[model samples]
Target: MSGVPMSGAPAQPDPYAAPDPYAQPDPYGAPMSAPGGQPMSPGVASAPPYGQPMAGAPGQPGYPQDPYAQQQQWAGPVIPPTQGGGSKAWIWGALAGVVVVALMVGVVLYVTGGDDETPVADSSATPSEEVDPSTEPSEEAPDTELVTDPATGLSFAPMPEPWRDSTANYGVIGFYEVTGQVLDVLTFEDGSGWIATFVVGEINPSQLGSSSMTTDDAINALADLVDGAHYSKPPDFTEPLDGLERNEVEVNPLTVGSYSGSAMSYHLSWDDDSIEETGESIALGVLDMGDGRTAGFFLSLPDSVPDEHLDQMLEALDSLTFV
Candidate 1:
């Protein structure tokens, strides 16, 4: 129908009337304005293109070819960006919340895991209790049967039927021995009870041997020796031994009869077990080696074990031959 000519002129219908989805102007590069933009009559300027509302048209809307369909405070089909952005905002907020939760978890793990101040560490702390000089040795005598060689002062309690006595040990410091061999009635110098094994070693009182010293100094010196630094008597962490503490260790001239040699006296106690949230200051006496300088070995056992009965240890130390 677009090619049909006008009845009056018999002229060809406008070839451009068939709407080109692309081209708009009449064979011209000018932007197409509106369909009714031209005059109603051939030479009369009546109204603007369909886009502009005629002054007298009273709210007549724009035409089909208008670039913008509706124009006012708002326009048509106002599709917002990405579902109105509210849902997107919620989604992003959830994602952010997850990230925050993850970060919080990470921080909690980092802060809580593997701190230096652990209960195990506190549990393992060495203990020191004051030696109760008042205690007397028990009437019980040494279990000489446990003695392997009385001549050499070397001994171990008699092993049970399947166990053996005086087994030679291998590897590491002052002879460390664990009785894989079945044994019972283990006894030491004090005859208090059977110990798993006896660790015999020596301490080398630093070049500064027995000089004038306070009891505290002696304790510090003792603490240092047990720390495996027999050659260097380092100062102890000068804090009171609360509960059970590995207090001080040191080499001192403990004269018993005519014998005077370097002895490592470890100050240990079961004070902590007796008190709540703390330990007592008590000593568990472990005597000196036959002839050597030592600070001492100390361990804090929570419970008491005839620790006050240290006469045997004192006797043994006193009996040691310094030569």
Candidate 2:
């Protein structure tokens, strides 16, 4: 009975052997069975173990219902971090470009300043044409004006335009030609019936300190000298010859344009040969300019002439100047 084997004895499995085929497959490979021997229905996906991607489960169509199952395949390629050294280099390069642009602008401004002489003509405006000098109206020279004699240091106002300079030498006196004079007298004529005579002469030095002639007498003598030289008719010295009557003014020392002198005035009346038949022919002003010198001026205006002309002559006499 010992060698033959006892019926119904329990046996232990070998330690290093493969699993029996009838036993259930490993737990990790498939779903576990239910208590009644029916397989369990699929369960919800659990959180993945740490540090692993969720690929899929082991069953039919693995993880078909999981939302993130194919997320890794769908994502675009990863971009490396653009944080420290390369980023700073790009910023510095941009700053350098801006500084270079600023320097160029400064150079341009310095070369062309705000006050440069370039004329800024308006493009929309019409330009004006240049004018010719010959076509412009010119000013005409005056007819009656002042005349200066440099040699004699004299300036005569209201001198006639038609009068000329004389070549005749009058012995220590300056002479000017007059168109209206038939005698060799220095006469001036205004076309409107006015005549003036001017005489300037150096005096004898002896005549200054001890002259026998009184001032009034000397002035009268100058008048007489002019009359005798111009109108000496030879019948009676002062009679019906023009029937002239004379009135004299007191003579006094005066200063006329830098020259110390004596001055006198005279009024004359005549019957016939009077100026413009007005019974008076002339008015005279005489100066004995003293550094041994003298000047005599005579003016005659027809009554037909406007009184303004006579006034002008008188004004000219007042404004005499010696250079």
Candidate 3:
């Protein structure tokens, strides 16, 4: 009864009791104090919990406010606004360029003299002198005598002197008579035995036993007569000369006194027992006188005469004209 009789005495602790499951465990393996407990060390503050603000931070009560926090918040950089929706500096630059160009144009106009002056002519020259036409000398023409033939109604200027009409003495020297009416005969003797004769005539076809003949036919017939030695000797010869020679005849168209005709020119030479050897140049022509009428002419010149005399004879023939 001694061990079972402990009812009123204080219960002693149980050495083998299980611990309480609802109690908080100590984190640092030390016993935890109750709320309002004392710190483990003096004058050492505790750090805040993991994510809370501490005592002296920016919004809290103890420390001075942050120096950068009260300033204005920085959004970005600041830029000045433009006037007229563009830069004023560009407008000023353009105005300066225009002023410089105006100054350059003014300088160019001042350097060149500009187009405004009128031109004047020089006046120191002399005038030309006048001429007098009345004092000039006049030219005089050569002296000539124009003679008209009565039978053929033709006019001409004969040689100036020592040439005369010898028609009345026609057959006195034994020249062959032409087959026509003898109109005129001009004869010249140069005082040195040289002589020439020009004969003019109207052709008579009846004398040649023909009713009609052209001027060409008459000239051809005359040429054939001369060529056949019908008129072999010169005018002062009584009979036919020995050894007569005729050269080839040159026939040419001729103009005489406004009438067209033909002429035959040839040279004849002869050796006569009564005289020395001699030769003559002869030209014969036939002209149509119009209206069934015709004319003929003959010229004979000794080779001893100067050629100028022959030229004069031809000039006189050129001067012949119908009256």
Top candidate on lDDT is: 3
For each candidate in turn, give its C-alpha RMSD to the true structure in angstroms.
47.0, 69.7, 81.6
lDDT (CA) for every model shown? 0.24, 0.29, 0.36
Q: Write candidate 2's Cα lDDT for 36-113 as tens digits.
A: 222221112211110011122111111122232212100000012233412122222222232223323433444454
TM-scores for all predictions: 0.24, 0.37, 0.44
Model 1 stretches with alpha carbons more than 4 Å out: 1-167, 170-200, 204-222, 225-252, 256-259, 262-303, 307-315
**TM-score ranking from best candidate downward:** 3, 2, 1
Instruction: List the candidate 2 regions with Cα displacement exceeding 4 Å.
Output: 1-146, 149-152, 159-194, 197-215, 234-242, 248-252, 272-291
Q: Which order, best to worst by lDDT?
A: 3, 2, 1
For model 1, what is the error of residue 204's alpha carbon versus the real structure, in angstroms, after optimal superposition? 5.8
Better of 2 and 3 by lDDT: 3
Give the distance in Å from residue 99's predicted Cα in candidate 3 to where it truly belongs. Answer: 99
Candidate 2 residue 30 C-alpha distance from true site, Å = 99
Model 1 per-residue lDDT tens digits across residues 177-242:
111121122122332111111222222222113323332343344343222211111122122223
Cα error, candidate 1, residue 162 (Å):
16
The local lDDT score (0 to 100) that residue 218 gets in candidate 2 is 46
Mark the regions of model 3 whose C-alpha exceeds 4 Å error after superposition. 1-143, 171-194, 223-239
- Name every residue pair that clashes in candidate 3: none
